[model samples]
Target: MKKHNYSAGPSILPQEVLEKAAAAILDFNNSGLSLIEISHRSKDFVAVMEEARSLALELLGLQGKGYQALFLHGGASLEFLMVPYNLMTKAGKAAYLDTGTWASGAIKEAKTFGETVVVASSKAENYTHIPKNYTVPTDADYFHCTSNNTIFGTQMTEFPDLGIPMVCDMSSDIFSRELDFSKFGLIYAGAQKNMGPAGVTLVVLKEDILGKTGRTIPNMLNLQQHIEKESMYNTPPVFATYTSLLTLQWLKNLGGIAEIEKRNNAKAELLYTEIDRNGLFKGTAVVEDRSKMNVTFLLEDESLTEKFDQSWKAADISGLNGHRSVGGYRASIYNAMPIESVQVLVDVMKELERTA
Candidate 1:
């Protein structure tokens, strides 16, 4: 049976990207050496690193915009601290928007450095919606927000233009849709969601934003040091970075973000339309703030849960269960998820309705 993947992170990737990555793993560039075994300092890997950095900026339309893209380790969790470490001065404060678990984690880390302000939050409402009425203090070092809440299925469709620099964690939704990438002063994302496999995180930031914190930053955590060394500050995640490069190349060949956005919208519409129209189901997130990447919904009749679970499993559908915090089904239709797979889930929903 052909399985339809819907796992949230370490999620689905393009078929072609996976095939290419598999080939490279055994024999990279026909060099008779595995990609993981090759030295990071080797010329072949250096070119890969350079191209990956360049292509990330190019895809976001940030090239020639004083932006430097770095593929680093430790995922977005580490960036929670690295952001404040490199951006927040000893006495300066930072502002954040609490939209989901990851955003809250970032706020917690920033507090250790200095004052961290949460301008607005929907946590009071179980994060079913994004807070719209809030003010970012202009005196803050930077304003941070998560573009998508994978856990709650909420995404920020619009961003506030504060006078201060804006930072964002785009882990779950990066490269899935079109956006004004240049508007953000800094962007970080773990590659597992939409970019590639786990183990590498992409960091794109404006060069001018660094070296001004007036505090000593450790070499490993310093954005300026990583930039100066051209993202080769240490032995990088060779396989992850190369696979990410392959995925980016795939996106570029498919006409980049503009093209992918259309497909994402279509998928979201197909699933959400079913959720709204079906008598047996309804969405969990607010209609206006629903995420295009993660479609979360629930059964109207909880007694039918066993039947519905069996139905989806029989159809070879995987990763449809929601998080523990939200009890329901979550269909994470990311960039690489085919609309055909979504049709399968919708069909399963309709079947449950007809037999109920």
Candidate 2:
């Protein structure tokens, strides 16, 4: 039986991208050199780097608008520190909206560099809903938030413009939907979920937002230096970056973010309808705050967990387990995931309900 992948991070990728990536690993561009063995400075690899950066900006609709896109080494977790290190100063204050674990992590890092005000948080309700109607102080140097919560399965439907720089960690949901790209001063994502595999992170920043913190940032941590070097300040993750270029090409061929968003909505709606209609399961996130990328639900009867687990596994479903904090099931339907896989999961749920 064919298997369906729903792993949250390092998640599913387009089949063609995978095949192309594998071929490059053996003999990249028919150069008799594996992608892993090639020098990042080589013209072939440089072309890949340039194309990937350009494609990222093109997909976000920020081309030629003074926004630079960089493919870097650190994951989004490192960005939690880089954001504060480069943007928040000793006297400056930043405002953050705490939606989930990643948001809280960012807040913790920002507090180490400067004052960080948590404008709002849903922690009071175990982060089931996105905090709403909170005041973002105008005095803040920038406002930061996680666009989507992978752990709690909540996503911010709307973003607030506070007249300050806006920073977002879009790790789990980037390229999955369309958003106002111009509103954010910076957006960072680990290329593991929707974009590609692990090992590379994408950072898009407005040129004016950098060089304002007045603190001396290390060369590696300085976004300006990375941009100056054209993301070749050092040997980049050649294989990962090349794969990302292929994946971005695939997304562009599929009609970009608008097309992917439609499929994402359809997949989420199909699975969520099954969860709501089935007596054995119920969704975990609030109805209005549900994430289109990560659809989280739980077994209504905890005692039936083992039976349900076996049922889904028997059907060749993988990675339905939820985060430890949530203690339920999470279906991470990213951009590369087909609607048919979602239909399989829905059928499994319906089968469980009928058998029950």
Candidate 3:
């Protein structure tokens, strides 16, 4: 049977990119050395580093706009601490919007560094919807938000005009859609989800935003140091960085973010439509705030769970199970997920509806 992957992180990558990465793993650039064994400072790897950074900025329309991209280690989780540690200062507060698990984690980390205020939150209702009509403090150092909630299946469609520096965790939806890159002071994401495999995190920092915090940042956690080194401050994640470069090249060949977004929307609509129209399944997040990347849903009847589960499994669907926190079903349709796979899942749902 054909496999349809819907895993959230460490998820599916483009077939062409995977093939190229695999070949490089064995003999990178025909140098008879694997990408893992090559030295980080080598000229070949240096070129890879430069191209990946340039491609990221170019794809986002941020090139020549004072934005620098860095592919560093330490997942977005660590960034939960680094953002506030380096940006938020004493006698200054940082504002955040709490929408899901990751957003809450970011808030928890920011509190330890400075006076962190949650301007808005949806925790009262189990994070089924995105908070709105909340006021962002202009006097704050920066306003932070998570672009997409993977576990809760909620995403912020329109960002607030905070009138201050804006930071975002775009782990689940970084290159999946187009955004106003200039409005954000910083954007961080774990590359495992949309960009490539696990082991590296992508950080886009506006050079001017640094040095304003007035605190001595650790050498490892400092963004300016990484930017200055061209993402070679340390050895860096060699394999992951190379794979990410391949993926970025694949994206550029496929018309970049604008074209991939159309496909992402079509995939999400196909899955969510079935969940809404079918009697056995219902979507978890609110319609307006539903995530384009992770479409979470639940079975309407507990007794029909086994049958539905078996049906999808038989259709070669993988990672349809939701997060442990929210027990239902989640189909993470990332940038690399093909629409044919989505159509197959939709056909399975229709079959279940008829046979149930």
lDDT of 3 by residue, 1-356 (tens): 44999998889998888889999989999999998999999999999999999999999999999999999988999999989987897779999999999999999999988799999999999999999999998899999999999999999999977678899999999999988888899999999999999999999988988878888999899988988888999999999988998998888999999999989999988888888889888998999999999999988898988998899999999998999988898899999999999998899889988998
lDDT of each: 0.94, 0.92, 0.92
Task: Report the alpha-carbon TM-score of model 3 versus the true structure.
Answer: 0.99
CA displacement after TM-score superposition, residue 48 of candidate 2 (Å): 0.4
Clashing pairs in 3: none
Model 1 C-alpha lDDT per residue in residues 1-356, reported as the tens digit of each score:
55999999889999999999999989999999999999999999999999999999999999999999999999999999999999998889999999999999999999999999999999999999999989999899999999999999999999987788899999999998888988899999999999999999999999988887899899999999899999989999999999999999999998999999999999999999999999999999999999999999989989999999999999999999998878798889988899999999999999999999
lDDT of model 1 at position 164 = 81
Candidate 3 off by > 4 Å: none
Q: Write the residue-wise lDDT of candidate 2 on 257-311 in tens digits.
A: 9999999999988988888889899898999999999999999899889989998
Distance (Å) between predicted and true CA of 103, model 1? 0.6
Index of the highest-lDDT prediction: 1
Record all residue pairs in model 1 with backbone atoms less than 3 Å apart, i.e. clashing: none
Q: Which regions in candidate 1 have their CA more than 4 angstroms from the true location?
A: none
